[model samples]
Target: MDLRHFRYFVAVAEALSFARAARNLNMSQPPLSKRIADLETELGVRLFDRTSKKVNLTTAGEAFLPKARDAVRAFDAALRTARLLSPSHSRRLRIALPAETSRNVLSDIVSRLQQERVQVHLVEASTADQQDLLTAGEIDIGVIRLPVEKQGLWASASLGQPLGVVMAAEHPLATVAKLRLCDLDPYTLVIFQRRFAPGLYDEVLDLCRAGGYVPHRILHATRMTKALLRTESAVAIVAERLAKRSGEAGSKEFIWKPLEGSPLHWWSSVICRANECVGLTRVAVDVILASLQQHEGWVPMPRSVRAQSEDIRPIEQRVDSVNAH
Candidate 1:
């Protein structure tokens, strides 16, 4: 079996559906099925046990999956090493960070790295994509939203964002010194897309509901501007930094206050392959952390790190959040 077989096998193994794997690989289901069949025939063992309703890995498949993933990652690392040897890219470092990271903080990270003769191959990806890219060796280090499974990776201390309400200065609850989740009951909620950080997204809504926050509706927006819109009738759930920025931008049109119980929060961390956090990779993480703390006003921890719900929230909640704002 060649690299193509490994790639196809890994895709199918991760997705667990021939149809979904084919779509992800930009191929067809029939050909994908044939490739797996060819792989199994060559190995004299079956990898997946397929049923009409679901797909599963055989014992042999389960045993081989890690090795397969390692091979793919090794190949990718080799290519990156080869490219890094070139004079122009000798100090180039590949890293991906979350979308919500401040532009000024990003600029500071880039500037600091440049002073060390390191060039950043920065990719701004969604929270879901950071870990996948890091695991696949597509990036040397990744800054991802926290509370993710960190089984085989090196992670930094999580930096938490104090959660708050951002609303037009004229909104009914804007003048409150501190707000509770229940205070947002009457207005729609403006929040980020769930695909960015599934756990965090669900936890926000679940915690809100559990704390007696029953919004008239929920709205999700991929863009900051849209999420910040309709503030007269919406209460945007945001980090303190974002709230402050909005408040500054609107020329006193917006106000932000911490939650009364301070239960809501967001966290992020800098991560790299457990064994690969050295030299420039280490520098990148340091610069990011320092920049975030000093330039972006993010805290090392939230005022209150309440226990988060282990279970994901219902799908209908996500659907409503996505359908509006």
Candidate 2:
């Protein structure tokens, strides 16, 4: 059958009532019944058991239901891809990111997309929540923190920066050239909540454990390092990029110093559903990688390689903006 048959079959299977399915499809019962019958005949099996009282899927119907839904979903995604590429249709890419993300990376990617005449709508979400949204198709793609479980999704670490500690400028540890994970054991540590970045959160804790220190007083929140360190003798582990953009760190108020021993690398990744069409999402992923490559610690992939399977044109111009988020 066609896509329409799959759509009709899904609606009927879900509703389990010809009258309800017809009404939901905005068609009459006879035509809807005929369509189901046609689909069953074409498939050489009955898809539903019908009687005067109720309608239910037979054994064969149960087996075919999932396949039919998959067909409809694929068809819908193809239509969405066509609509996205048309000049008449608005080319808006919906991207989700962690609440406390790098300012320069996001600004650079947005500037690049705007030059290509594409609009980006950004949503602030936790890394865990972004994964959920990506799987459900609520967002086009997401920038998530590393150490994430792929769960059969497509993801890669697109950008990385050295992780450091942010603390009050007057704190005793500020005089040191660099601080290690064990150095913060004396003060309360402020870190991102587990819900926001579970992988990163666990990594920080594990590092502390390895350093022979289990942080007893840890504050977990999604606030700026300045605010987090203001109330008490506390420190927050953050990316060097975020520390530089905070401005408070450079002033007399705060100080950011890299970790000693092996440095901790804060990584951000781009993720999308495994089966999603990559026409528009591919462009957004490239913009992220291109913008991040300018950073000191970012790893560059080969120019000839594509992150996604789709073939897309490269953005020719690089743009910069002063915005920070």
Candidate 3:
């Protein structure tokens, strides 16, 4: 059986529904069903037991599922290795990043790599979804928030930044030295949607709950800009970097204060599928780690480093100012 057959088989086994598998594979149900039938015929075993109500894997199918998955994974790994070793092949490194990560950080990394003549492509996505893509070999590396719990992935926590509570400049809390969880219970709270920032969202809820009150009102937003704009009569807890940028953009409407007694921090890192490092991937990882180390403990880089790198300068400057305060 070819890789395509294995792919079809794995899809069917995972979904357990021909229709759903076909939809995911971007093919019609009849053709997908026929491929599965052919696979079973070749193997001399019934992989799936079809029923009027549902489809279920047989014992043989169950036993073969993991093997099938491993086969597909191995083929992908081999293909990647071949491409990596072939000088004639265009070496394109694919990186996935979270949407909340500062554009400046991304731009800086890209700029440095481009200057070094590294061929790369970046995919922006949520941390959780990006991890999945990495696992499936859809991407080579991922720069995402820390605390990811996926198995077979390597992650490093490079640095952490404090989260800040942002409010309209005219809001009473804006004058406070530090904002407490209790202080925000009285106001509506705008938060990142669960899918985009599950860990952060859950942490915020847990912290608020421990303070003896649930947030009075909750508004969900997918994007930071949307969340900030929707903060009518509400307070937003966002990354310090985000708050600073928003404030500078004449959020003359808003002010931000460090959260008091909150363990809220933004952690960033570079992650990849475990043990899958190749030449380009290794170089990319090394560069990212080196950059992080060079800028460590300073909260941001000095003006020289920032000026030397156009993409990263703005973020570095903002981070430096925040740390200076």
Candidate 4:
């Protein structure tokens, strides 16, 4: 079978629904079903047990899945290696990005890479997942959230912005110009998930306590606070610049306002395996730095040895003054 068939099977197996898999694969459900049927016929075994209520992988399917993934990975690795050795091959770079990464930052990076004649493949993942992928040699670069594990990795934070409050447009507090920690105490608030951003989540909670204000109630959002904002009247905390730059600014259903006193910030960084910083990874890092330097509030990491989340405090002092508007 071809890589296309492998991809189709993987997508269906992961989703456990032909309709969902078809949507993800950008194809009609009927054709996807036919492909699966043809594959089953070829293998002389049913891969998935189709039921009216749900779809599930058979024992045979489970046995084949991991091998299929390895096959795909090996093929891709071989193709990339061939391209690296070929003089006429165009340059390609794979970058892992968190789902909530800023659109402006991604746009700028893509723009710069295009100008440099490099093809970019962006993989959406969490900060932790991206780190794992980077460590495994699956991706050349990762632009992920801060507080990532730094062992065996070279990482630098370049973007930092004050946290903002997100609320439904109809919420009374949405009309307010700016909000203080105490102002949000009366409403239920949604914080970014601790698993996804433990440092930022704790920082926000600590800031509220320092102000002597505890929220009436608090909840957690999975990947982005924007989804919570759409359905809940409760406020969500997120980076103001990211909300605007990511096109959430145009949403008539939600509004984001800068926090008063500006005590908390969201940070992003570029990370890769420490020892593999030659060739494409090195070039990707330079491209990231150049793109970040052009932005107004982005702070370029120091050129010295790699720094961690603790090192960001000093940089915050300098950037806070500039971003306090």
Which candidate number maximizes lDDT? 1
lDDT of 1: 0.73
lDDT for 202 in candidate 3 is 66
The local lDDT score (0 to 100) that residue 281 gets in candidate 2 is 64
**Candidate 1 vs candidate 2: which has greater lDDT?**
1
Candidate with the greatest TM-score versus the true structure: 1
**lDDT scores in order:** 0.73, 0.70, 0.67, 0.69
Clashing residue pairs in candidate 2 (N, C-alpha, C atoms within 3 angstroms): none
lDDT of 1 at 127: 64
- Tens digits of per-residue lDDT, candidate 2, 161-244, equal 667788888888999886777777888888877867777677668767777657778887655546769887888877766776
Q: Estimate each model's TM-score.
A: 0.75, 0.62, 0.69, 0.59
In candidate 1, what are the lDDT values of residues 1-325, reduced to their tens digit?
A: 7988998999999999999889767698998899999999999999999999999999999998999989887887797668657786558888787876778978887888888888788898876777667666678777776556534577666677768777776778877876888878888887777867776787788889988897777777646544355543687777777756645334577667779878787776677776666666777777877787787776675323342222111101111110100
After TM-score superposition, the amount by which residue 231's alpha carbon in candidate 1 deviates from its true location, in angstroms, is 9.1
TM-score comparison, 2 vs 3, better candidate: 3
Lowest summed-lDDT stretch of 10 residues in model 1? Answer: 315-324
Identify the runs in model 1 with alpha carbons over 4 angstroms from their true place: 18-53, 57-67, 70-90, 168-172, 175-177, 214-217, 224-232, 244-255, 302-325
Which parts of model 3 have CA positions greater than 4 angstroms off?
Answer: 1-61, 88-91, 170-172, 211-213, 224-232, 247-250, 278-280, 289-325
Ordered list by lDDT, greatest first: 1, 2, 4, 3
RMSD of each: 8.5, 11.0, 8.7, 8.4
Assess the local accuracy of residue 2 in candidate 3 as a C-alpha lDDT between 0 and 100: 79
Q: Which segments of candidate 2 are over 4 A away from where they belong?
A: 1-90, 102-107, 224-228, 295-297, 300-325
